[model samples]
Target: MTTHITGTREEWLAARLELLNAEKELTRRSDELSRRRQELPWVRVDKEYKFETEEGSASLADLFRGRSQLLVYHFMFGPDYKAGCVSCSAIADGFNGIAVHLANHDVTLSAVSRASLAKLLAYRRRMGWTFPWASSGDGRFNFDFNVAFTEEQQREGAVEYNFQRAGHAMDATPVPLPVAQSAAMTGTDATTYSLDRPGLSAFVLEDGVVYHTYSAYARGLDGLWGMYQWLDRAPKGRNETGIWFRRHDEYDRR
Candidate 1:
């Protein structure tokens, strides 16, 4: 009754073998790209940025937590939002399990957001997550990192994200349905929701100084969306249409 191609075992194996060769080549190319990312110059971070953590006020360097490297997931929980962005929450769901492993390997993985420390901690408890989440707290940390934007920036088209000047889709008239829906879920309008974007930034500490290494945004974050990586190998393969994901806890509410 299936419409998919029916094949003998031999035929399927032959096709799979051909795909395996391509997959191997892709793996090698991915390795090369990673090496190139590591080779990118690290700019010294001299500007002081403060964060509010569960342990009280902390410096940007402190987030490294004795590790040489730090990976920050620029979470999209703006100061106004009632809750975190659904998409961001989905991406963060995988962080708890990997945090310990990355810590042992000398890389500290934490999430930085514009939300207050209290709000972040409450949400972490709601989601049952223990990964370090810090609040940038009305500081320029998010702006300097290009993950958060201002109302003026949005109005004047001064936003630069993913290393380029780009207009946010949420600004368009008749805002995209998914954007509107997500904004509603966050208890904000589309414009407010769009101000805070999601991204990942890397930093390194050496000789008692911290350096900004690399950052990615937009589709560049695709690889870090753990579900998509698994879905890519599934039969339906991401088969998405108009925001099919939600915060892991929301599914039961439906």
Candidate 2:
């Protein structure tokens, strides 16, 4: 005897064909991303910043660590935070192998954060990550690049430049603008706070100078965010769900 099924063979086969179309679409899209990664639109770095590496203090350019192309994962561990964001934490989990292989292509990758060296080291040890993680604790590399929010930038309206707080308290609630009826709220305003974009940014070293290449945010980084997707995109999607939460047993919240 065979297990009963709901649909006809033709219907089942058609359904699978639809899934194949989706998978192929995603494959083409992924390949396009790979092409985009070949090289980024370059921008020259005008200001020099600093970071603390295991070797010791180094300039922003030095984070390249003698590599030609650099890709920095802006991990979200704020200056005062005790830990990194779980989303970012998950991404770092898959960075192990890529760390070694990317070097073969003259490309280098590192996780950059504002956490102090001691804190970064402790956390890296706990995560068992082998990638080179650096601390930009004393520098404005983060703030300048719009990846780390600083209290000063918030007050100065450098980011989240909302006008509602023109004369209001930073702690005061915002008064919705009457004009909002005509315009969709930008989710943030002049008075809103800026958390900076904690994602990926690339650079290339030319004539011994680092040039800002490109950056991405949110789902845009689904490609290199981890290896589970890369592995799942193979012949079979995956044996199990690819998501997990704080604990190894608990599933991550959708």
Q: Which residue pairs in candidate 1 have backbone atoms (N, alpha carbon, C) closer than 3 angstroms, thus clashing?
A: none
Model 2 off-target regions past 4 Å? 1-9, 33-40, 152-197, 227-244, 247-254
- Ten contiguous residues with the weakest lDDT in model 2: 178-187
Off by over 4 Å in 1: none
lDDT of 2 by residue, 1-254 (tens): 64655678999999899999999998999899778866666788989788999999888778877889899998867655555655577788878877888987888899898878888888888778879989988688876665666567566654431222323232333533322211112223323222434568889999988888877755566776555566676655545432333422235666
- Residue 239 miss distance in model 2 (angstroms): 16
lDDT of each: 0.93, 0.68
Query: Could you tell me how far off, in angstroms, the CA of residue 102 lies in candidate 1 after the best superposition?
Result: 0.6
Best by lDDT: 1
